[model samples]
Structure formats: C-alpha cells, structure tokens
Target: MGKPKGRKVARHGGNPNAWREPKASSPSLSSVTTAEGLLEKLQSYMESCEFVVAEKFANRALERFPANSRVLEAAAECFTETGNITKARTCYLKAISVSPLKGWRKYLGLAQLLEGQNAVLQYTRGIEVMERELAEVAGPAQVETPNVPSASSSTEKDTAEIPTARDISNAYLSISELYTTDLCDDDNAEEMCKYALDKAMMADPKNPEAFQQMANFFLIKGDKEAAAQYVKGGLTLWYTDHLPPEQRISPENQQKVGVDYEEGSGMPGLALQIDTAKALIECAEYDLANRLFTEFITHSPTDPELWYLNGFSYFLHGNDYYPQARSALTKAKKFATTPHGICYDIIAQCDEHLESIAKVLPPTEDSDNEEEVVQTEDSVNRPEQSNCEDSDWETDEEGCEDVEM
Candidate 1:
C-alpha cells in the first residue's frame, strides 16, 4: 500500500531527503558577534561591580539590539549584585521568559537571590524547578559528599553515643527540662520526651530512666497500671545502682569501668541526677525514688524541692515509710503549704491509690485462700465483690475463713 499524503516514514524505510532544511539565515554569525562584543563590555563592567558603568553599556547595547539576552542579563546582574534585588529579579524573569531554554537557570538564580533575603516560599518553589531540570540532565548524576554529616547518620551517631543508664536518664530528663525551661509547645515537649525515652530504652534496656519516662508518659495519658509498671522498673534499677557506688567509687574501679569522672565537665552533673530522681518519684517509683532523693539530699543538703519530693516519695510507699513519710511531709511542710503543693498534693492524692494496698494488707483471721481478699474499707473502693462474699460468710463453703484488715 502507498503511504498517505503527509504521512511520516520510519528512518530506515524512507528516502533520506524527507526532512527539509531552511534557507541560510540572513542574520549571519558576524552580525551576532558584533552584538556580542558590545555585551562583553557591559559584562566586564558588571563584573567590575560598577553598576553605573554596566548600566550605561547595557543601555547603549540595547539601543541597537533591544531584545539582546546578554544585555538584559548583564544589566540584571549589575542591579542584583548592587542591592537592587527587585529590579534584578524582574529583568531575570524577563530574560528567561524570552527563551524557554534558559528558564531553569534563570529561576535557579532568582531562587538563590530570594533565599538570601529569606523569601522561603519563593526560594523553595524555585529550588523545585531547579531540581526538576537537574533530573532531566542526560547523564549519571555526580555523587556529592557533604562536608557536614548527613542528618540521618548524624542522628544515628547521636543516639548511639547515649549508652548507659545514667546517660539515658540524663537525656530524657534534659528533654523534660527543655519543655519546662525553654517553654516549648506542650505537644512538642511531650514528643521530645517520648523520643528521648525511646532512645534511652534502646541505649540501656535496664535504664530506670527509660522505664520512668514511659511511666510518666502513660501517667500523663491516664493509664495508671502501665505507668505504675514503668515506675517500678525504674526504681528497681535505681535500687540496684544504689547497691554500691563503691564499685564505681574507687578511681581505679572507675577506670576499669571506663568512666573518667575527673575528665568531666566540672559543672556538677548533680542537677541531672536530681531531675532523674524527681522523674522516678513523679511516676510513683517510691523506694528507688527515696534512695535517689536521699543521695541527692546528702550531696546538696539544701535543695528544698528535694526534701519535699523525698518525704512525699516515702509517703507514697504507705506503711513502708509511714514514719519517713511523716518526717518528709514535716520537712516539706516547712517549705510549702498550699493544698496543691507538689509534695503535699501528691501525697494526699496518693492516698486513694494507696488504699488498694491497705485493703489486702494485714491478713485477716481465718484467711483461707492463697490470694488475700482486700475489701475497700473506705468510700474510695470500687464496690467490687470481695472473696469474703463466698457462701462461707453465713455458712460453710470453700472452707470458710475470715480475715481482718
């Protein structure tokens, strides 16, 4: 079949003269060269940083070649370098608009100038265009290594370096400090705390700080049991650490552990330790909380909040530290009195949680079940059935046994 009129043919299947050539151009290379010479002089003036001289030359060139790209670009550059960004940007846009091929470079230059002035939105849009042009380049992209580390790798290294219960604890506590001290947004503050907690757990599984942070997060979220478990875990670690700073006490022993206290940042890391202890207490990790509070007290001997938290932490332990709790409350009382004092308010509210332990405590007479029954003797009780409700209360059943609270 014959090809249709004006139909194209595949290269190898058709006559080679199918494509036509235009007649030789009237505007010869010499004429363009003549115009380029004028532009070069303008460019030289612009490069010399003499805006007046550059503008003069560009105006003269434009009179002869009103649409000359080089003249426009030179004038724009002069204005741009000499602090006339508004005018420079307008000229650049015009030059690029005059030629589709120059669009990307023009936009890139404009973006750079805008960025210098902090015009983020415009600069970012220009950057997008520039990147698109880069992607279109017909070659393998160069692999450029940044002088500074990549953010991802840098963060990973930072996370890796914070290994150890103390380090993890300090890290989380500092996050809290930033929230409380730097007045960061509450949501962001919480996020920062959570991030540190995740890192702390990865750094040291047994780090009390990690557990305590979880407890605090949950407590804030109102999950009491989960919070309690975390608090317990943290305090447990704190207790273990307290077993003996002796292993870590001797300089020789410290050297063996690879810890160089002498090479420290001189500013007492005491504040961090104190804050960690406070977190422990906040999550109701009482026993270890007391230990840490005591240690801090022994060291500083005058931190008012330490005294209050110490006494309150003991109070939270119920009978375990009834005497100590009273003592702490007394000391804390000296420094505070509002019904909502951090120590007193917490101590009082803790009474509700403490009531649970109080119920099952002090095995009642004739207690038969391995699981002790703790009936809420107070109004705070949830009104749930006690094991004492067995038929044995009135008659023999399941080996009736009575217990006293």
Candidate 2:
C-alpha cells in the first residue's frame, strides 16, 4: 500500500526548536537554536503522554544548552512534575542565571517552586524580591487603564454574600488571639495578624475594632505608613460616633488649647488622650505620643496603667531613647513587680508587656542569646485562622474595655 498523501516520516524526532519564537518576534529566540533538536524530541514525547521519555529528552536539552533559559525552565518543570524538587530547584536556578530578562515570569516560577516545597518564608521572600526587582525595572510612568472600580472600593454595590461570615470572623479572631498567646513566632504572628486584618475587614467593614486591630498589625510589622492609615481610620470612627470629637480635648484647656472640648470631668478626656497616645505610639508617631505622654503624666503621673503604657512606648524606641527607657521601665517596675499593691490584672499586663518588649530589644554583651527572632518583611495570604471551627470563640474581658469606645 502507498503511504498516505502529505505524510512524511519524522526525522530524528520532532525539533523542540519548533516551540521557539522567531527572532523577529522575540530577540531571545536567536540564542535558542542550541537546544532546538532536544526540544523537538521532548515536544514529541509530551504529545504522546510519555512523561518519562519527555523528561529524559529535557535532560538531554539541559546538557546541550545548560545556560539556555527556555531549556532550563522546561527541565525544571519536568523534574518538578516528577517529584524531583531538588533537581527542579537547581534547574530553575540555572534558568535564572541564564537570562535575568524574563521580567516577573522567572520570579513567579521560582515562587511556585518554593511554595510547592512548603518553604513559606522562602516563598514570601521570593515574592518580596520579585516585587522590588520588577518595580525597579518597570518604566517611570505606569501604563494606566480605564478606571474599572474594584469591588472593595465600590460603595454603592451590594455586599456580596460571604456564605461563611462566622468562619471568616473566627479566622480573624484567631489571628488576634495569637498575638495574645504566642511568644516565639514573630514571623507567623505578623503573617497571621495580616490575615486577621483582611478577614476582619471583610467580615465587618463598619467595625472600628477591625481597623484598630489592623493598625496594631501594621505596627507589629514595622510598617509605619500603613499603620498610620489604619490608626487614622480608627480615630476618625472614634471622633465621629463613639466619643464625640469634643470629648477628645480637656475642658480645662478648651479655651487655652483652642480646640473643642467636653464640658465635663477630665476623666473622659484623660481616657481619650491615653487611647490616642497608644495609637500614635503604635503607628511610630513618637513625637506626637511623647507630647501626649508629657501632658498625660502631668495629669495622672501615679496611675499604674498610664505609667506602664508610657514605659512601654519608650521601650519601643529601642536605642533612640535609652536613658528615658531605663527611667520609664524603672517606674513601670514599681507598678508591675514591686509591692505597690497594684491590681493583679494590671500588674500581669505590665509584666506581659515588659516581657514582650524585652524579647525584641537588642541584647547586651552578657546576654545568653545573640540573635533575635523578628517578623519578616514580607506579605503572605495565610490560610484562614479558624477554618470554621465553632468551638474556638470565647469571651475575654481584657479586650472588652476597648470595645466600649
């Protein structure tokens, strides 16, 4: 029988170079010819669903064009699919070494590889690097598209049904719980805090507590600008609804201070000052917090909680105000560990607060540990904190006081 018309026997398997774009379309294509033959063989095997043979073909391509970005990418992918993570990582590194011109694609692939291996820190670190590198390489002017409103920004749009409000609420709540519970996991704690902030924001947009929680999250992450935004949002909510703006200023200084003030006892004004001072401190607005702290001490210098807060704020400055921190913490010790007869709960809070601050401080020459564990400078969309576990929710009196405002 005669062979089918237009059919030709394949010679030396199909050419992998067939997948390479033309030089006119991609300048990178010119150097890609070295692996064309092996690429063709791999392509043919892949088409036939012969993964083992395809991987073998890819290995051969790597031998011929070890520094070819496309070949290395293909080899990495092949090894990854076959559960050879070590080899896959090596191939990916080779691809990155070959051509650093793939923009975000190379970093994105590396992120995937790191993620697959369950290296959460490494994966997040890769993303951070990619973001910075891509930003640096991007043109001065951004290519703007027509304004398409995001769902989060569209106020008039109906709230999409979450279908799992309780789950989401629990998720955020659980992350908040970690800040109060765990001590050693600053990295996970910060990530969890962000997860909580996002989940809580989705759960209740109108809740000032959610915004306040996010402010603390940013503070812990050392993002002053982001923390300030959330703190401002929370403060706006406080002034607008809960504690009328007038109550924010002291009545005694209303005329002299040239600001609106509550026409009553200074307790409310004192509380507002304390709360605002704490928020400012958390946002790294040390100058503002210091000014407020000076005024607060003039009014109630002996108050244990106020002393604790002032000392805590000072400690947060680290090396910036060592002498002041030493004095403040000494005063705080009088309220915390000394036999001043302070409330047990207040004393406990002081101890916990001091411990947390001490752990983060730079160690002295005689300290046992040289290295300190700190939160990472990376973002992560962590899994839901609660995952719909109903039994996790419990009433806590400590955080309840803040809710009243």
Candidate 3:
C-alpha cells in the first residue's frame, strides 16, 4: 500500500523516453562573458543589417570592455552604420589611443570619415602601420607559433590578427585614390599615386583592385590604350573566359592564371565586374560591356544605375542598337522616377539620349511621308538633256559630204 503511494510518471502513447525537457543551450548574448564573444555577436548582427540591434549590443560591449581595442572598433563600426558619425569618430580615436600600433584598420576607418589632407594623413599612417605589422610576419621560417593559452589566461593579444596580402594592397590602392582625388593638386600627387600603385602590385600581384587602380590612373592621364590593357588584366583575375575575345585566356594559358585572392577580398565580385564593364564602355568595347551589363541586369533587375549603364553601352554602340538602347533607358527612367526618386541628372541624361534617338530614328509614318514627298519632287523636277543621236546624225552627214567632195 505504501509503495502504491509513490509518485507516478506520465508516458506518451509510444516510447516513454521519446521526449524529455530540452536541455538548456549555450549562453545567449546576455550571458556572453568574453569580449571576443560579444564582438562576434555584434558582427553577426551587423552582417544581417540589423544596425539598431548591433548598435545596442555594441554599446553594451563598450560598457563591459571599455579598454578593449577590438570592442571599441566594433562599436565604431556599429555607430558608422547607424549614421552616428560623431560617436564613430570618438570610438575610433579611443581605439587608436588604446592600441596605437596594433590595428591598421582603425586608422583606415577614421580616414574614411575625414576628407582632403586629414583623410590622406590617416590613410598614410594606416599604411605605415600595416607595412610594419606585415614585416613582422613576413617570413614563415622566421616566425614561431606560441603555445595555446588556457581560456582563463588568454587575452586579445593572444589572438592572431595578421593582415592579409590583399589588405596591404588595398591600403595602397586607397592611398592611390586619395592622391588622385583629394590630394590631386599636391606637387607629388602623380608620382605618389604611381608609387602607391607600384607598391600595391608588388604586395599582391594578383589583386584586381591594383590593376583597376592602374587602369583608372591611365584613364585619368588620357592613355586609354593602357587603361584598357589594365582593365583586361583586372577582369582576367576573376572572369578569364568571360572577357572579350582579345583578352580571353586559352585553356593552356588558363593554368598560368593564378589569382592570389582570399575567398572574400576587396570589393564584391559583382561590383568589380561592373567597374570593369564601365571601363570597357569607356574604352569603346561596347559589345563586351553590353554583355556584362545584360548579365548584371538579370541579377539586379531593378537597379536603375545598371539599366542606365546597359542603355548607355547600347547607345554608344551604333545606330543599329538604338532601339535596344531606348528600351533600356526607358526602364531606367521608370525605375529612377518611381522607386529611386533621385538621380535627376541621370534622368536628364536619359531624356537627352531618348531625344537623340528620336531625332535619328523618326516615326515610320513620318519617314514614309518624307520618302513619298521626295519621290514626287524628283518626278516633277526631272531634268532634260539634248539628244546625242541627232547630234551624231548631223556630224555623220557632214563627214559623208566632205568625203564626196
């Protein structure tokens, strides 16, 4: 009777052990103890474009790890995305102050927020830091791996934060851009830009950005042929077979085309492709540009800029492609007006192109009327001439009389 009074267990219809209370999972964001954990969570939010959530998480991380350079940098990225430039600048400055020589990215981040000489200065400093850091780990044989530290004793310093080759190359590319733009009037602008580009190529010979930058430099110098060559070089890095006929790599040569790029480096592939296509258009490679722009349109159907570019490419091609150009520009105009609601200059340009096309390609009815009018005018104003047969007969009779005499 006492045994019967023991607690009873409920069972499902099939297996009694089939389901049990789910075990507590790993800690959530609220329970994240380490700065690294918080930074990871923050990055996840940022990647998802959840800027508000990222900003809040970043603020929390800053409070938890006030002196952590990475945490500060992460917070700064959050602020920058959320349009809080003041706080972003402050965080970047603090991060630099905390560990001035350790992170080159912080300097670049701050540089992006500034302009003109100030931006140039920051970019230069960032490049210097990157060079120094890279030199430390230049040779694998010279470097020694440290023992893995226990979790409790590990710090951010124990983490490997080495900059990749592409990072250094892109840094130089940024300096090259600054020299071409904000510092264009400086005495050594062209020379500095060339130097930076050379360093970029040396740092990463396979970098598309370096090639594209060189192309841009040549284009600015009005050397279109050189620009086109560099554009081909850049495009070859990613789209070897998709390039124009003159630039496509043969099967045998494809093996020689070695790209030294990480999985995700510099700009997105689509953007780089777009840039190369633009360069192609600039270099009068209209057919190839149109092909790339068409593919891009399929991927980004509603992108007004892409449509405009496709239209521009067709428009520049020749009179035969006017119709296709008209269709693309019309779509671009519609997208720009309804959704984008800006790019008035682009809209104007589209209108101008449409007008030019209309002038060149008149309506069928009007052209038919013009043709009829021309035919009628030609028939009404037909020219008259003397009969050569009568002149020949008179001349022949005179010659016969002279012979008889």
Q: Once superposed on the true structure, which residue ranges of model 2 sit more than 4 Å away at CA?
A: 1-171, 175-195, 239-279, 291-301, 311-405
Can you tell me which runs of candidate 1 are displaced by over 4 Å? 1-215, 224-240, 243-268, 333-405
Worst 10 residues of 2 by lDDT: 370-379
Clashing pairs in model 1? 364-403, 364-404
Best by TM-score: 3
Instruction: Give one digit per residue, the lDDT tens place, for model 3 in 1-405.
Output: 011122335653554334444237422446676887888888988998988767777887888788888889889989999999999999999988877767788999999999877887887888877776677778746644444322222365556377888888888888888898888999999999999999999989989889988998998898989999998877776665454455555764455332223456443466677887898888887887787778778767977688888988899898999888877877765554431123345556777887898899764664345435534543443323323343321222122111100
Looking at model 1, residue 391 earns an lDDT score of 26
lDDT of each: 0.49, 0.52, 0.73
lDDT of 1 by residue, 1-405 (tens): 111134466767966446544336321222333556766766766666766656655555556665544455666777777777887787666665554332334444564555322332333344344343444443326533234422122322232221234443444444443444443455566676567567557656765555755776777777767877776565444333443556344554444432112345322245445655666666566777787777667655644466667766776667667556545444443332221222234333334433443464443342212112222212233223444342222222232121100
Q: Which of the two, 1 or 2, has more lDDT?
A: 2
In the range 286-385, model 2's lDDT, one tens digit per residue, is 6656656666676666555566567667766675664455445445434332221223354445456555555665535422121111111101211223
Q: Is candidate 1 or candidate 3 better by lDDT?
A: 3
Lowest lDDT sum, 10 consecutive residues, model 1, at 396-405
The lDDT ranking, best first, is 3, 2, 1
Off by over 4 Å in 3: 1-33, 48-60, 140-154, 242-267, 301-304, 330-347, 364-405
> Residue 348: error of model 3 in Å?
4.0
